[model samples]
Target: MIILTGVGDVKTAIESLKHGAHDFILKPVNVEELLIAAERALERRELLIERREYQVTLERRVEEATRDLDAAYTKLQDTYRATLEALGSALDTRDVGTQSHSRRVHGYSLSIARTHGVPGHQLEDLEQGVLLHDIGKIGIPDAILLKPGPLTPEEWKIMRTHPEIGKRLIERIPFLRGAVPVVWCHHERWDGTGYPRGLRREAIPLAARIFAVADAFDAMTFDRPYSRAISFAAARTEIHRCAATHFDPAVVATFLSIPESLFEDIRRRSLEP
Candidate 1:
């Protein structure tokens, strides 16, 4: 339907533009011209509305896709972290006597790394390495690992294979490859006397070196079947004594400088049985 209105020449044209009217005729009107203009105006309005709707729909879809991508990314991160924790737990469970050993080693290693000013990324690697350091023990025969007495020469040979076993196990998992060196070499000594390659001094990976100190400290201070747990003071002395032999001298020095109270607290927390 075509509608036309005019108060005067100028006002009539202004009103048509402002109100988006179909058409306006002068005092002498032409019905045919008005009808044509009305049809064209309505068609243009429909096209504009459709274009706006299309744009809005496109934006909505883009937002939804972005949300989906974000959700997937979050799930991936959660899965990776859970998998790491589970692997650590699995290794721990394999050794019934060492129930919370992995967790304690992780905490102690990070603490030592922090005290020694290890770099951020390196510290993270150290933590992961320490948590899974003994994972290779899983491959060893239960008789050797759970023996009531000291291992015989042949049993010791079999037991010493764990580092390689652990390294191989972790290397197969892509995310854990960075931690394999530490897992493989944590048993190595600073003076070139330890096993699984006998990598010594600076030749050993720094993460492994750091973990070695933390692992030994925990081992010495914790009660085992063959020995009683030592005092923090004794543990400190032993760490210092082994500085240049079993442990990196600099790392041991740094560890000694850490307050005794800290080690005591860690020991207490770890004993939450």
Candidate 2:
């Protein structure tokens, strides 16, 4: 502020100064001093304008960078899922009679997890885990993996090692690291009788727990060479009966609560070409 007054005392000048007066000019103000004060104020105003513009530009740049990061993250996720799908498809072909089973199981597990209130970020890992749950079969001999009859005790021993094999296969991959638990522990029982590692109850990762129910449901409901397909109702009854023994009771409840129509829808979509 520039104060121009015809009469003023030291006290008034001090008060004006305190009130933010840039210049206090008495009557007969010098033209040169007035011009200098006006120039200084204009210069200060320009500096403030420039500062504001700079801040606005900086904010805009930050917003643009944030958007770019989000897009890149989305693309990376897509790539990861595509890779998992390709790997799953390859495994399915080798297993025989299980075509599209992984896809169906993926849908079921994701639904069960969402209904169970699993965090959004972990859902992707869960999906990947479900799709690749049998990845370790790659390490097994074709003779054992493709056997038409029930596996012998020796073959079963070799078969169970597939989970360990799967862990070794994926644990080193940075993106698949979160999914290792499901691959390694999907066969574990809620009663701690599960193989490889005896993780039981809450000691098991929630993703693996949710996956166990989904996998068993798919296996029971879908036809495989060794087993005839059962009705969804029958499968649900068996699943419910096994709660707290083969499946986590809480996860079983969540699975049972999911609308049957949704499960049918996921199954229908999974069969599409």
Candidate 3:
């Protein structure tokens, strides 16, 4: 059956033809014939159907491509995370005392950062920085790194090169460029007395400042070659005493405010056999 469209008083002409007109055409149309017009309209309908089918096929292909791209992206992210974890693990293996140290520091740094209202994007960089803070230690000799006794002034001077080494290492990796400052400056003191570079106060990167407190707290609370683990309260007191001198005061305040249970949990997780 023909369907009439755009008709404007043209139905009268079709009606006058008296050939049981099934549809009408509007102005600017020739009213002299009807069969040829019907054929053309039918052909247009068929063409429209073919065009719609092509569009449906194109849309399906597009959706499939999008899904494939998403899957690839997810895989890439997973691979990158695995690589980072593996690199951290390798560094830990080189220094048995450092096993799980990076992870604990990362957790602590992230907690302090969150408490201090660091933006979400920067928090991610902080976490990574904390994990790799000691990466430069890889460059230190085993005699210096695992020495049972305190370092001599000369040896200490040599040991201080790790941060710069770590910064160099990370600079070579494009994905970790944002974390270079944290690696290089985590050892810097708030009072401008620390090694490598004497960056003081706000001049030090925030991530490094946050990491310093966390790293020191973890080191004091955990068993080390030179000393036994201290109680959490003792550690907290020591951390407070050093605020503004050894660490950023604001970071120390936040660190002190963290519940003891949180430190316990961190210690527990690190102690897992």
Candidate 4:
């Protein structure tokens, strides 16, 4: 701005300049001096406007670039999920009667986790962990993994290494690192009798504890080559009875609180093409 003032105090000129005045002039102004100051002030105003417009344009471009990056990230994440799902499906099909088991257990574990108050950000990790809980079975021999009857002690010992194997497999991937706990500890028992690490009670990660209940429940309620499927109520009763031994008591309670209908719905949806 250009300020024309009757007061010629040096302090007044300085103050006007300090208050964003481009030029300060006395009232007995020379027309040529006044015109020159006016031009300078107009130029300064134009420059300020241009700077503001440039900043706005720059911000708009940044926002657009950020949105594009976000879209690319989301697509990449979806592709990873699809690849993992295919791997999980492959693992499930390797067994004699466990087709869709990974998907069913994934849904069950996620529901129980949500009801148990798992944080929203961690749910993706939980889902990946549950779907790939048995991924280590890929390392097991077909003879033991697909045995029509009960496994012998030696076979059982070999089979129990799958959790560690799965852990090793998943931890190597940066994005899947969050899922390592569940893959490694899902077979662990609350009473410290489980395999690989024998993590007990609260020592076991909550995601692993949650998966234990869901996996056992799915096993009991689903038909296998060695056994027939039981009613959901019966499976729930069995799970409740085993709480604090085979499963986390708190996770068991949360799993029980979920409606049986929800489990059925998940199962039906998993079967969809």
Highest TM-score against the true fold, candidate: 4
Off by over 4 Å in 1: 1-79, 271-273
Candidate 3, after superposition: displacement of residue 181 in Å? 1.4
TM-scores for candidates 1 onward, in order: 0.71, 0.90, 0.80, 0.95
Error of 1 at 101 (Å): 0.7
Model 4: how far residue 222 lies from native, Å: 1.2
Residue 74's lDDT in candidate 3: 96
Candidate 3 total steric clashes: 0
* Per-residue lDDT over 81-110 for candidate 1, one digit per residue giving the tens place of the 0 to 100 score: 667666777787777466677767777778
User: Clashes in model 1: which pairs?
Assistant: none
Clashes within 3 Å, all models in order: 0, 0, 0, 0
lDDT of each: 0.81, 0.91, 0.82, 0.90
Please provide, for model 4 over 44-117, each residue's C-alpha lDDT reduced to its tens digit, 9 standing for 90 to 100.
89999999999999999999999999999999989988988898898889888888988899899889989999
Top-scoring candidate (lDDT): 2
lDDT of 2 at 243: 99
Q: State the weakest 10-residue window (summed lDDT) of model 4.
A: 127-136
lDDT of 1 at 238: 91
Ten contiguous residues minimizing lDDT sum, candidate 1: 1-10
Model 2 stretches astray by more than 4 angstroms: 5-28
| Residue 20 miss distance in model 3 (angstroms) | 25
Per-residue lDDT of candidate 2, residues 42-97 (tens digit): 88879989999999999999999999999999998898788888888789989978
